[model samples]
Target: MRRARLTFGAFGAVTSIGGFVVALIAACGDDRGGFIQNERAFETEHEGGAPDAETCFLQCSLDGRSIIDSCTGGVVETCADDLACGAAKCQEPCAAAEADRSSNGCDFYFAMPRHYAPSIVSCFATFVVNASNKPATVSLELQGGELDVSRALFRAVPNSTDLEPLEGPIPPGESAILFVADWDPAKPRSVGERVDHTSCPTEAKPALEADFGNFRSGIGDAFRLKSNVPVGVTWMYPYGGAGTHYPTATLVLPVSAWAKEHVVVNGWEATLQGIPVTQIFAAEDDTEVTIIGTKTVSNGDGFTGAAAGIPAKMMLSKGQFAQIAQTEELTGSSVLSNKPTATVGGHECANVPTSAGACDTLAQQIPAFEQWGSEYVGVGYRPRTKNSDEIVWYRMVGGRDGTELEYDPVKPPAAPITLSAGELVLFSARSNDAFVVRSRDAEHPFYLGMHMSGGAGRPPKVPAYGGTGDPEFVNVVPTGQYMSSYSFYADSTFSEHSLVIVRKKTHGDFKDVWLECAGNLPDWKPIDNAGQYEYGRVDLSRQFGPGDSFGDKRCTTGLQRMRSEGAFSATLWGWGAYASYAYPGGMAFRKLVETPLTPVN
Candidate 1:
């Protein structure tokens, strides 16, 4: 199994800003709102509809000064040929085009000429906004470095686990503020004052510095996150087992860095960004803290001490730290939530697409990742109900061309694909049906799920009239069984898909040998005759354990029968009521095993 890679470092900083004082200062100043009218000179537009570079540059330089000049299709030279600007020059060559189109994702607002600064110290961080119907207000937080948020109102509410919002609404078209103020008159303090220059006049030519690229702020111990296994949530549980009904497990990933955007107020190492490191455990020796289980945190505000002078702290007991040490050793062997890499591997491939279209692809395909023996687990989405017994499969259909979805049964659609570790491969549910790749262990069993329609609106809704949604896909191997790593692939950009080599442990190792067909169940039919030519790939490192359960429809199948009382919403707290935790049931029902299919390119 591949070890999880650290993607974004956890950096944060928190400083105080008075209400009236900040409002007054902001009112008096003409903030140099970072605007990207044209993408970088060298960067191409992913949508393939970007205006000409000359047109964009002309529009951007209506004020009579070229901030960034295009060099080639991939590079941009900042500042004009004439040294006609202020101090601080663009260190890195700017893109000729305004957009980083190669990756097919949104361009960084910092890449724009309006706010290109080589370094950012005690100032506003770059804000990015997509071209949506409604504008977006980008909120800036400095976790790894120094920042102060007393003046800014977080667009999203604060959470205890981390100092950044796990989820929030960034409107289309609208814009927000992320100003950096090192010296506040009201506070009468600075991150150590270096200078107190007056605001630049709106008409004055600005300095020729480049915006501070996304950099780390600081890092430290934050929170401990624990997974919760609900009781009686669904029929997925056995009446009893060798262990207690509630299995308590703790996984910890240390926070080593943070951002020092505008909100940071003090020195580094402040627990400003309370990234959920590991779940608190009862076995810990520290009495000052207790296990609060796990809950998804939102916003960039970590739980700080009520008092201003006291530093924010969530110190785990020595025993707790020991537990962290033990679990940290688990690495690629175990699961660690909160750390995007553990939930999904985004760094496996040496190179991953960073542009808009492909960026979303990276995000969507990561969760589909699973380690072979240690964590291989099947992931079946909500499936379709059919009157015919034809082999059925599931696909990922909607969202932006590459907008990926989450796969966590608990965090459905939250992060359908986490690219913390590697490149992303988006799947069109219809064009890309789920298939089992070969397994590794013979005696160790494997598991699979029949994708159904429902939840994130990805699955087909099963209608009444004796309609059984999706296919009841059972595992090819039984408990204590094993298989080797298998390969599974489909058309990269289509929705109607096929699966081949569905059953052999050693078959279809290469992409060419496997033949495909148009209808579902590609391998069930004669492949040599008339099936299309296609292939699928699977990784075996991501394996699952017995009782390691996943299948939203399984529990919903029976639970939906009891839904006559009223239409209900899935709540985080009420997740257990909807979930089921059971040992891989008897083979007669569906063989449960350790090996599962994790789709990757």
Candidate 2:
């Protein structure tokens, strides 16, 4: 995580109609002729694929002039001579023919969350997408519990599995679905036939299954994916209780973005009949993790518990995950790790009060406090039913005891609420309403967790979309953390796809934002504002272009890119009647800034 700082100096220039330009004549006239010659030579030698015409011109003019002024009477030399002398002056260094390539090691740690209930279900699946250009040889190691792991690789056209071992190398752009716990092969076969492969294929495709299995689920269960090339990881709760319960899934963040310290658990709604649990994992072995929670609790399965009034410290080796189940709503609890650690927070199963729908689990990996923001805009899927209301839980962490926070659209808008570190406040509205939140002081940044309801449901209606109205847990990335561009993969099965965009309201009423789907741009709509923040929603499903799909498939599983001229953060929300999930639109690594590297416990 490195922050780059750039400084620019002003240069006055005079231009003629013929395009001739002059500036700083008094200071630059002495060696102007030599400068022009040196500049031309430098450009001829090093201007291979200039970044831009303006940059090239500026470099040639400023750097050439500086060199001439410094090296008066120096003879002009060719690029070859400059290379030998190593004295070529230019705005940018010459491009290297064989530039050093940074190594993105194959080692990756994935934090797996507990399914509906470890005791009731043991089935869990992990999908790995090899997004890199080169093939990847991957190995899996499970921690915290012993569960049989099965792997199946899927490739495009002829979708054959090369008689090679399941642990064999995965071709570039291909994907492998690993089923852990008790899985019934019959279920996958029932949904789609599996073809035997003579060799690994080149293209990639998505695999659908009816029921993977009903095996034992474990808390703090984790797996390490060591690959020769960089890959993307996604965890799937396929179908809990074999379709009796709604399914949910999330995109896994790379380990490089993991942080050493986090304001642990986010908002928990115990009123929803579901229990809130948080799973934490360490990336390195012998990692010391200190847990401070709201109350004392007992450890279940491979999880460790902490006592109230006194923080509990535990040592976790690499790949180890700890599940902390809290009976009471847990917010503001802190988890400080000596080594980088990852965390997932949400309920095993929950229902939004007053929102119609059966309880479904909602969980999201909690971003570290270092990524906390002072501003956020709340958004959600359309209401499942007209009677059902949408709710956004605003949990603030890292603030003083009396830190005041404000919100919009709540009416004479009750007075600002005072919250201390780890405290939470709630706001409710129609599913279509948008709202904004900001802290009184930007210096004291705070984090926000947005929980959207699965919506009110009617039996047999299935809500049109899958998960019909499954609850969604998305950790809102702050506006300050937004990136200008992003590339990501959408869930292949999700029937509805929408992107929630939030921009600083102060930036003006409108800013150009584009969603490039399979190379086509689509129009997006703006929503009514709350305060200090503007909102926009893009329906990717409805905007898919001709090439956005395959043969008959309208939405294929592939990379989708987005860009914005102004600062803004976006979250991709996808759901069907059966389940729903949301993830930040941009890569987490892009938001990272260089910080202290802490040692393991």
Candidate 3:
């Protein structure tokens, strides 16, 4: 739920700090101290009248404390009680970000998805693109389980002819990093059209898969990556490795994107393979996590003691993770943590629909609860097989009580629905279908996920337009999380690679948005409800494929970037034969609440 924001004070005040100065403008509110609410020098909320600048300065000076001149590196200045606290807290992260500017400048941790297929160790490949040019270094250590970390943790230098590291400092203006090891010489010469493996050496031991057995508790498949520079992370299963499923690669969000609360979302798990699993890894020590199951759930064998209304709890240290798995779908389950955590939802093999053919590996990172939005533009994936009428199922889960949902559809209309906290509504639509979901407001945000089952029977062994892909589940990116620009990869390994983009119709025409590979946007249709948003599904397969390896300036290859003058949301999809995968193209990851989030006491 969104919290109340403290309005500004009444009068404007100017202060000089170090070499820079900033002016903020806000409307008037209740009087605060001697300044108008909009013009307070500090954002802090004070009961009654706030302390005057001179008074706060005296308070801090009397304590023998000096304040940092700026959140960025700045000279020390005489402290004001009001500015002292805010400056002190902001300086910590700001200073750290500067130190880590060579790489992603935030906390770094990852709980990679577990893709389990029999007979093979399972190919779990992770790529980190050093987005910065400085000679930034990165280290990855296995966490969470008692597995053989030495063997499972791999270090790769993709550009090196041999498995040696880059001889000198890497160049500048680059934003990604790739690790390469000759794990296997006989594997496919290429993983997907997404990246060039022709230069990757083929000499190493077998690839390592996540330790699924340790998921019942904590301390298993999680891993932590540390870097001095800001970088982008990507995870792909069986891509370069030897496996047939887990078809897609997703842009991994950094630890700054992690949150304290999340709700699980996944495809149908009652398949011949393993069950669906929802996992969380803590970023701080002694973190407390609670799970409220939307259905009967268990980690492994017996019921986990978490049920529809009951909650199960766990204690974890930094880098530790907990998994809640059950054969039944755990879509509406909720997880609460005292500290920030990476929340993931996946299944060993899941059927897109109860009757779809060929179950495939399903994995997608679920966004933090605070990231869910009151509004969503939902679009269905194109059919891969002959069934042109492929239907995508959607589930909108309410985050709070008394949440009323309104659905504006481009096709068959949906009736309004009311939901209590944690409750969800399900609906089905076809490829051409587009809909908008709006709640009363931000406080009643909801989570929505999409599922694609084979049109009818089993998916064909070869690629088919309407007949493609087995059971697949992907989150519907909310309009609120939409970002203005994104750098993402597409594994055209599937015959079909596409993107669904949603933006406010009031903005400029499609030409304003530019794609690195595909020139000029195509296939745009205006959304009906209030004529507020327009949806587009761009077939970008030509941009991906056999060519386009490493770029001249970028440290990596086969990567694509999109930019727009306006804010928008997008989702990526790919399908080939019975293999298909989908996920949000990117996210804003901005804090939804005005107040810093605090754990429920």
lDDT of 2 by residue, 1-601 (tens): 1222321211111111122111101011110111121122211111112122122111112111222211222334222312111112221111110010001224556543444443223335555655334455666666534333334443221122122325456664455555533333344332222221111111211122222221222244366766655455666664222233445566565565576777665435664555777777787878888777656655555445657545677777777777666566556677788888877777767765424466677677776666555545566655434465544434445433545555544321332456666655554544456665555544345666566554454344223222454666767665444433343445445555666666543123344555544222333444323233456555555322222343343333334544443445667766655566667754322222233212111
lDDT of 1 by residue, 1-601 (tens): 2223212110000000121000000000011111122321122121111122122111111111223221111222234432211111221111211111010012111111111011222222211212122223322222223223334312211111111221233332212122222213333434323232122112222222122232111112211211110001011101110011111010111111100100110000111111112222122234232111112111112222212222223333322211111101111112222221211111100001111010000000111112111111233321222333222222221111222222211222221332211121222223133222212222121122222211112223422212212111122222112211111111011111111222211111111221111111112221111121122222111111111112221111110101001000110000111111111110111012223322111
Runs with alpha carbons beyond 4 Å of true place in candidate 1: 1-314, 317-384, 388-428, 435-601
TM-score, prediction 1: 0.20
Supply the TM-score for candidate 2: 0.63
Q: What's the candidate order when arranged by decreasing TM-score?
A: 3, 2, 1
**TM-score for each of the candidates:** 0.20, 0.63, 0.69
Task: Show the lowest summed lDDT stretch of 10 residues, model 2.
Answer: 94-103
